[model samples]
Target chain A: MTGYLVRRTGQMVLTLFLIITFTFFLVQAQPGDYASFYVLNPDLPPEVKDQIRAAFGLDKPAWQQYLIHLKNTFTGNLGVSFGNFPRPVLDVLVERVPRTLVLFLTATAVSFYIGFFLGKAMAWRRGGLFEYATTISGALLFTAFTPAFGLMMIWAFAFKLGWFPVGKFLDPLVWRGADVSANYVFGNMLLSAAAFIAFALLVMLCLKRFGRRVPSVAAFPIVLGGALIIVAAWALSGIGGLALDIVKHMVLPVATLTLISFAGTMLLTRNSMLETIREDYVMAARAKGLPDKLVRDRHAARNAMLPIVTSLVYSLIFAIDGSVIIESVFSWPGTGLTLLQAVRSEDLPLVMGAMLFIGMLSLLAHVIVDVLYVYLDPRIRYQ
Target chain B: MTDRHDPLLKVDGLSLSYQTRLGEVQAVRNVSFELARGSALGLVGESGCGKTSIANCLMRLLPDNARLSAGRVLLDGQDILPLAEEDMRLLRWRRISMVFQAAMNVLDPVYRVGRQIIEAIETHGVESTDTAARERVARLFRMVGLDPQLMERYPHEFSGGMRQRAVIAMALSCDPDLMIADEPITALDVIVQDRILRELKAIQQQLDMSIIYISHDIAVVAEVTDVVGVMYAGRLVEMGDTSDVFRAPAHPYTAALMSSFPSVSGERRPLTGLPGEPPNLSDLPQGCPFHPRCAYATDVCRTQYPPQARYGSHWAVCWHPLDATMAVQS
Candidate 1:
């Protein structure tokens, strides 16, 4: 298993290298660089335009610039963003990526919960009205156009109902004269979510170590406690109102993403679930006298989760690309939106940096899914 | 009847069908049988003759589309058919566990073999503590000729024969009174099949419990079973002591099965195949299900289903029961 992980990590690095090489050349191969407009401007003198080209390092040939780019990338120098001039691309990303993550992660987690829950029930109680309704609706949600659906979600829940902000990431009124930036709060939200997950995992591990009866029963309280801690910490913080404003702004986008993406999970889960319920192990489990619930959940649904887990991770990374559309639709200023604007303005450094980030994120997620499969499915550990 | 043993399981007129696109399939039809305590009964038949349906009915593990239609499964004088789902669950694996075919890979691939067995033991409250349950599993592993350490390994880690043995150990985890092994070794190699059969017979005797094995292989059944039942088209055609049925098969289907098998005692007969395929379950032949394939099938056989006929202690459903004098080298 360790050997497999090592090999997978090597493959991932190799894959990331290839992706970076291709993306750098492809984005560079475009008609012009970030200084193209300034270089073309007749209003500016030739020397001044040359200085502009030299300033952004576009005066060098593509090959020399490629070598420098390679060296800088290897040394973790993403360079300064021309679009957000005077700001380092990494800092810009650091400020924005977490918001996308905060939005994306919440949406993914919520959808997974709803999808998996409904999926198991729909599969278990097949050939019923609930099954039909969930199946049809899930398919519709999955097939629906994201922008239109986002608009509808905004139209109904935000515009008409006025339950949430119509657009953007935060209320400027809440942030005025505030000590902290929205970026700071977004970073903390992501950190708190990670910490909670780690805490839950630790509790699960301890429960597993001590053994049965109380593990499942005890996990509930521990998780609830962990959640309570996160909530309490957030409530007591100075940026509590700022965070609330961001959350209120988040409702429309998050709800839209959740609604649109949940169908993919639900449909996959339902199909996987249907296949597993017919498995021989399910019958054997029942014959072993396991209760209806245990047989369905432990033996059947547990096996069904293998594909869903891998799909979930891949789609989360995959959703990064989709989220460009999402971030634009709701005017959410995440990295997806930034990446898009950078591309439009030919902000070469920001574009390349954002592309590399997205690429690396997907590659890492793939490895995580592969590694996770080795644990979730014992059969894969051998390979 | 030769010093009748007490019956541990009495399945009376049990009927079962499955709802399919083609319409209802009468999978098991009026199948009635009694399995004695401390005995191994083998139900032998062709692939689609409802052998597994019978086993499933006894285990109450039928699929959603399947309908019992009518039946009574009396386990130790308790009519288990009408028992509540929860009550049946309590009785299953605790009182009457089942072993599925080895080819089915019945063990959950994610769980360790030992953990799976321990789950069965745990589910039925067979052991007071997890430690004691592990001990029981270890003992069962030993009984089935598996290393206790191998229990920690996942199902995919075990060989087909080892997995079958693991399945056997799982079936015996709760020390149930009755066990139904449905084509348990059909997927195993010849050597493994022999070893599993020997271990199964030994376990049945050692534990003094009843075992019901459903198989299409007559020789395999003969090696492990004390009594044998021959089924045709979802109906038990012939049944009696294994030796009696093998020697004086009264039903033509039974005769065909006996003749098709290699026999050391009987005079050598050319291996003759039963002429036609088994009838489709949805639309069975009007009379005895085996008539279309029975060489001795008469007009009465085609017109009406046969009544029970006796050939010494063995009974068969046939219009023209084979004479005892014609027994395999009596």
Candidate 2:
């Protein structure tokens, strides 16, 4: 475990370095710098504009400016915004990072857990009614209008029916103070943690209990109830309220993203399972007087999961890059949205910061997947 | 009348066919045999002669397209063909288990070998406690001549022979009454094959389990099995005690098969290879399927199929049986 952690941390540092290098060069290659934005503002005196440019070291060579940016980034100084906000780029990111993490993490957890078991079910009952329905729905929902699909859902639930708030981070009333009472804070934290644990446990138990059996009458109702309860509890809490609002705002985007992602994952898992099931060892497992479900899960599914794991890591990296469109559609303040704003305003520091963060995240995802590949499959190992 | 001393498995007039996009392919036709309890019966044939197909049908492991056109497979006294999928699941691995070819590669690489066995046991409602399951797994490993300590290792950690042994241990986990070993030693080296066969024989003696062993090697079958069946064109051409079939093969195909292998005793004879490939099931020649390849083909042999004739305990499905006169002349 210690060795794994050490390797992962080393890889993470290398990834960050690459991200910083790429961001530095890419930002320098852009047409204009922070000085160009200031030059466009006619109200400012020419001397004052030159003084402002000099203050930020914009007049220096691009290479020198890049070194200064790197030093400032390391020392917790992201420099000022170009849109006259007078705030550091880091502060803007800090305020929005939590919101994005909450929304994305929740969606990821929900989608992964749900999609995995559903895919398993579809594979197990390849020709049955439930499997047929899921395959068709999954293909249709994901293949058609991925991004617009999310908007369609938002229109139906929030705009058409007024079932939930349409778009925003939160109500802002609940989390107004950073240093709230310990009891309230702890209570909220415990509730959120407990909820997460419960949902995870429920998903695991469902997968375990009904893994082999055909789709029972109770399957759909039980899953629907569980999803409803989770959504309700999440929308009711302070942090959850913020998360729920983001989710509601994200309903269309996530749905669109999940459709395409689900298609890829489901196709991969189904093919792997099908191939693994035909292996001679599978017959050996069946010959052991083991039940069909046990043979499928413990023998077939476990082996098939190796490829799925790799695909998931690649998907995560792709997701970070793909979030730009979703961010624009929802108007949710995130790195993707902030980067776009920086590009338009010619804020070189902010653009580099956002790009570097995304690039690092992608690299980190890749490293994590590579390390896990070795552990999950004994065939792989570092020399 | 059901003989109390009869074999544990009896497959009578079994005919199996598979439907493909082209047409129906008759893979196994009118095959009949019995496996005495605690004894091994070897099914030997070339690749397309339906050895594996027969095994699959006996285990009811055929794909969705295959159909058992005729005959009955009696496990003890129960018919296996009409059994429900769930009922088959119950009987499989418990009453009748299989050790398939290339089975070493079948272990779940993600899990430890011990946990996999434990999962198998728990799935069948064997051991409720982890301790009990571990103890059972250890006992199984010991029975297969493997160290119990190695159970914690992953499948990839074990050598080929060791992995096959682990698979054997799993097959024996439930103390199955009948174990179908389908070319279990085919993929191993000659040395490892000898070792695994020896271990299997010992385990059979200890447990008194009947095994339906399938192989293409006539010599290997002679060493391990009491009775042997030689198949040709999806049909059993000859079947009898191993000594009887090897010493005096009635069916020409069986005679050809025996001569194909060089005997260790240096009693060498010119091998008479079968002419032409095995019949294509979708478009088989009329009448006797083997007549086209048989040297003693006549008008009767080409016009009508031969019925199985019993001579003592041995049976042969040939119009012109290789009696002493024919054998000497050939």
Candidate 3:
């Protein structure tokens, strides 16, 4: 397993390198460079324009610039954003990537879990009311154009019902009075929870070493302690006022992403499960007198999960990539928004940087999925 | 000394049909049989002759569209048809279990052989502890002539014969009173088939459990089963002791079935194939299901359904049932 991991990691690194180089050339090949904005300016002199060109390294050969860009990327330097002028590409991305991650990660997780269980349940007793309703609705949502869906949701919930914020990640009016120290307190609380869990594990190991059966609820104290810490942090931070604002602003975008993505997840899970439940092993499980639920869950779902697992990993990348259009639609600040801004202004450096980050993330997701796939599917040999 | 009052399994007038898009298919029609304790009965038939359907009905594991329209499947004199789903589950795998057809693919490919068997043991609420259930699984693997160490391997890693043995071991996990084996060895080669049959017979004798072995092979049925029922077009056409039925088949279908195979003692008689296909259940012929394919089928046979003709201990569903006197004359 270690050998397989090592080999796969090596392959991932090589693939990422190839992808970065390819994207860099492609983005550079676009009609105009970032320095053209100065060239087109009426107030600029010929020497000033040449100096501006030299400043951005436009005078260098494309190959030389690409080699330098590669070196800089390897050395953790993503260069400067021509669109946001003089700001480092790393700094721009650092500010925006986390927001996208937070938004889409929540959306992805909620959709996957809900879709997975719902799909399994629907297929277990297929041709029933629930199956028919869910499958038809899932198909409709899956086939619906995403941006249009987002717009329709905004129109219905935000405009018509006037329940949620139309767009944005924060409500400035509510933020003015609310305490922002909740994030700090929450981080500390999480750290203490981790420490408690480690202590609990240690105690369990000690009990096992002394030849005692560790109680099943031995970690209950740690869990309770963690809950108390979180509650204390919640109280101390005065976050209730801030939470409503955040949740209100978050509703439209999150709902849009979840509604669109979950349909695919549901359909994938349903189709896979439907095929699996008909397998001879599932019949054998039923013949063994396993309960209906047990036959579906243990025998059917576990086998059906191979396709779902693969889709889940790819969906993670899709969720992140989809933030490009979603953030644009919602006017949210994220890596996708930054990439859009970079492309519109023809900022080659920033575009390449964003592409590299996405490429790396996709590579990482693939590697993780490959490892998990090997573990889940017995037929998949490491070699 | 077989008594009607105390049979372990009494399947009476068990009729099942599937509600298909075209119409209701009469998959099994009024099939009746009784299995005594510590004995093995084989239901031999061609594909789709309602043999597997009977096994499924015995397990109450029918598909969604299929319904047990009329039947009383009594285990230990308690009718199981009226039992709630929950109660039926409790009876399944504990009182009665099944070894499904295509044993090569019966065990889940993703799970270990041991895990799959232990699931059967644990799900029945027998030996709830993981360790205890696992030990039982290991013991079962050894019981079925497989190495306990190889129990951890996945289905693909094991040979076809070994997988079939693993399936048998799983069926035998709960030590149920009756085991319904539905064409268990059909997917295996002749060599592996014989080995599994011998092992199965040995286990049956040692465990002293009743068995309803369903198969298409007459030789295989005769090898392990004491009593045999020959099914044709969704009905048991003839049923008696294995030796008796093979020696002098009472029904025309059974005669055709037996003669289809070559006998070592007899001269090389011309091999004759039973003509035509089994009648479609949805649009069956008006009278006898087998009349179109039977050589002795006459006007009476084509126009009227045959009633059960009893000859001492044996019975056949035929108007002109063959007998020992007729066999001697022929």
TM-score ranking from best to worst? 1, 3, 2
Clashing pairs in 2: A150-A252, A281-B106, A289-B93
Per residue, candidate 3 scores C-alpha lDDT tens digits across B147-202 of 99888899999998999888889889999999988888988888888888999999
- Model 1, span A1-383: residue lDDT tens: 57776887788778878877888788887887787777667898988878888888888998898889888988999999998899999999988888887888889989999999888888888897898898898889888999999988889988899889889988888788998877788778777879999999999998887877554878989899989988888999867788788889988888888888888888888899999988899889889989899999898999999989988987798788887999999999988999999988888888888888888888877767777888889888544
lDDT of 1 at B104: 45
lDDT of 2 by residue, B1-330 (tens): 667697689899999999999999999988888888899889998888899999888778888899989999998878989999888877777777778777767687777898777766766767767688899999999888899999999988998889899888887777788888888888888899898899898888888888888988888888888889988889888888988888888888887777777787757777666678877878877778888888887888988888777655578888898873433221
- TM-score of model 1 (first chain only): 0.94
Q: Distance (Å) between predicted and true CA of A324, model 2?
A: 1.9
Which pairs in model 3 have colliding backbones?
Answer: none
Candidate 3 residue-wise lDDT, A168-285, digit = tens: 8677777775545434433343455467667667766676566323554665775677667755765676664565565577678988888888978888888899999889999888
> For model 2, how does the per-residue alpha-carbon lDDT over A171-225 read when each residue is reduced to its tens digit?
3555466354423443454456567568766766786576523334445666667
| Cα TM-score of candidate 1 | 0.95
Question: Could you say which candidate leads in DockQ?
Answer: 1
Stretches of candidate 1 above 4 Å error?
A1-10, A39-43, B1-6, B264-268, B324-330
Q: Each prediction's DockQ?
A: 0.75, 0.63, 0.71
Question: Model 1 residue B293 lDDT?
Answer: 83
The candidate, 2 or 3, that scores higher on TM-score is: 3
Model 2 accuracy (lDDT, Cα):
0.76
